[model samples]
Every structure is written in structure tokens, then in C-alpha cells.
Target: MTLPTITATRYVLPLREGGSLPGVVEGNDLGTYVIKFHGAGQGPKALVAEIIVGELFRRLGLRVPELKLIQLDPAIGKSEPDFEIQELLIRSAGLNLAVDFLPGSFGYDGSAGNPGDQAMARILWLDAFVANVDRSWRNTNLLVWHKNLWLIDHGAALYFHHSWMPAEKFATLPYDASDHVFSIATPDVPGVDAELAAAITPELLTEVIGLVPNEWLEDGDRERYLDYLTARLDKRSAWLPGGAR
Candidate 1:
């Protein structure tokens, strides 16, 4: 599936919830989005992780907002007085990530009802597979819109890429699911594992990886990422919940 690319037409405001300073912006497509800056301290690797993991979530039949590559123009925000944000905007004046804005969405409080065991299981399984450390009770990274739970902010996943290490080095690292927000929900992890293991074939990962912009990748970085994830996928049953198969 090809993702639509849009250019930022305007910067609306800043989202202060996190250190990256993702902001609201209008796209050339006439849609509003939450744009993650490429110049953020976490840098483009975070955007790469977001696209790959978020696409994985979508392919696994989970709820995540549509992602797009947003081309930012620094001139659009020249009037903003904040030197820090201005500097970030100027530095990030190129391709960034834009998440479709879900207006009126509220943080998930577990009130709308469970996201269903199977779906929740898939989520936990994906997080484990990617070694994501962001989802917890305090900051669920989940949103509730129209009574449906939507996953967001996956920049923290695929963290192994930050070091550009060999994929095999961390293949067997166990995921600590105890702190996962859905850990207590009794997710059917084994079933989810079997389902995803079959679904996330090499072809699927390639398709997901293709969604990332080329500039985000360094020399051989893409292959290393692909290798790392494939290695992790091969060992899912070991690191996933309920221990090794």
C-alpha cells in the first residue's frame, strides 16, 4: 500500500505532551495532521520507527491513524517567536511525519470497554516483537475516538536501529511485559503470536519498510533494520509472553 505524501501548508500549534514537540499543521491535501519534526533530538530514526511499527499495527488489524510524509517549509512558521521551536522548524524544513488528526479524541481511560482480547493481544505481541518501551499505564499512547482505541506515538519502537548494531546481537532479548498497560488484561498472547508470526512474513516487512523515506536511512541502515526485525520475528515465541515455545 502506498502512503500519500503531502506538504505542510501551515503550522497551527505545538503539542507539549512530549519532548519531541510534534505540532498541528495543515497539509496541502487540505487535511489537518500532527507533524513530527525530523530535527527533533530523537532525529529521523524516530520517524522511521513510527512508520514501520505503525504500519505493522495497521497490517495486524489494529487501530492506528493514517500516516503520511509531510514536506515542511520553514517560511510557514517564520512568525513564531519561540527561538527553540523556530530553530526546530528551520532545521526540519524537509520531509517529516504527519499523523491524521483525530479531533475530539480523548486519552483512553479503559471506559469505552476493552479493545477485545485478540486485538489487545496483537498489540502486546507487536510491542514485544519491536522491543517498544513506551506503552505503560501512565502514558498509554492510546487514544479514544468514536469509542474506538487508536494507537499512536510509536517513535520509541525499533530502538535497536539507534546504535546501528548487527541484527543478530539482540535477537534473543526478552521483552518485559510486566509494565505494559495491557499486561493485566490477560491477552491471548500465544494465539496472537501464532497469528502474527505467520502474517509478518519477509514480504510484509519489506512492504512496511518501503513506507519509510530514503533520507531517513543511512548506508546499509535499511538492510540492517530489515535484518534486525526479521531476526526478532524468528525468535518471537521466545521473547513473547508465556516464555519460549
Candidate 2:
């Protein structure tokens, strides 16, 4: 399950809506992508989180855009008019993360209607398990493309790795889903957990983690990620929405 690597051929535009300042890029494969720079404010760890969480979401049978490893050349953005953007490109030379650009897609709002109980529950369950705090109603981090829901911007998930804290410590941390975009939908998180937990085996996690680039991880970080996620999965009783029985 390796991600195909593509070279950034041109810098199309900057997406300033995000704090990280990702941009639209044309890839050597002739495809357009939303490129997340390794040099963004969040740094490479954000790209690592993006790959791991996004891939995990896809494996769980949810909708997410295709991900790729984008090889960037700082010179590509030399002609850019924005100094900040140009400097960002210079810093991001080498490798970066990118997603297939979905045209005609719009941010998810309540106007299109709810995604239903089961689907909503699944999304909520996944976010909780990964400790994703970015899917709040204010940000949503979801997209509507051709009337289908697509998850995006998982770089904010798996935040426990930012420090040296024991991964097990975060295993039981309660997720505040009250502000989740689907909070009003009343998802049956426990029921969804029962249906999905078994699918998150260590083997599946290993495969998903393998998708991340080695350059993006520091010494022992790979093992750390595996350990943390494994512990999180095993200790679901402590954080699986409903109080532990």
C-alpha cells in the first residue's frame, strides 16, 4: 500500500484559509493536488499525522481524497508574488504531502442534510479513536463533492505525539465531541465502536503507518506511533464515548 510519489511541476495558488498555508500544485503526472508543505507551521509531524490518520480513515471504508507524496522543488515557486509563499516553497523543498484536488467541491454545512445515524456514527467513532480535535462545527474539516462526504485535513489528529508524554496516558483521555460537526446528529458512538473496533487490529495499523514516509518520522517515532495507537485501541473502554462498564 505505497503512496505514489509525484513531483510538483508548478505552483498554482495558495490556500490561505488554513494556518499552514497549503497550496494547489500541478504534479508531473499532470494531476492537480492540494499540497501540504513539510515546512508549514505545523512542520513534518503534521504531514505524518495527515498520512497516518487519512489512510486509516480510508481503510475504515470512509471517504477521503487520495493521498500522495509530492516531491517539491523550491525553485518552482520562485516567480510567486507573495514573499511569504515564496519563502514557504523554499523551505519545503524535497518532500511534502498532497491530496487529489477535487473540483466543484464545497465545504460541508447542514444545508445538504445529515449523513444519517450509521454513517455519522462511524465518522464520529473514528475521530474519537484518533483523538482528532479538528472536526468541530466551526471548522468541520469535511467536504461535499458530487453529493458525497469526504474527510480532509487530518493533520490535526494524533496530537499526542507533539510531546514526550507517555502514549498510554492519552489512551484514556476523554474526547469532547460536543462541538463535533455531527454532534447534533446524535451518533451512537458505542454501537459504532462495537462494529468498527475489531477492524483496527495491529496488523491494519502497521500497514497504515507504513504508508508514511520515513523522512517524515524521527528516531523511534515510528515505534512510538505504533505503540500509542495500539494502546489507544486496547484501552477503548476508558474513552469509547460511554462510561466504562
- The lDDT for every candidate, in the order shown, is 0.87, 0.88
Worst 10 residues of 2 by lDDT: 183-192
lDDT of 1 by residue, 110-201 (tens): 87788878777778888989999999988999999988899999999988888866667668788898999889643478776666888998
lDDT of 2: 0.88
lDDT of 2 by residue, 1-245 (tens): 78999999999999988699999999999999999999989899988889899999999999999999999987886888899999999999999998999999999987887888888878988898999999987899999999999999998999998884787698887788788887753447777776688889889888988988888888888788889998988888877764433
The Cα error of candidate 1 at residue 169, in Å, is 2.8
RMSD of each: 1.3, 1.2
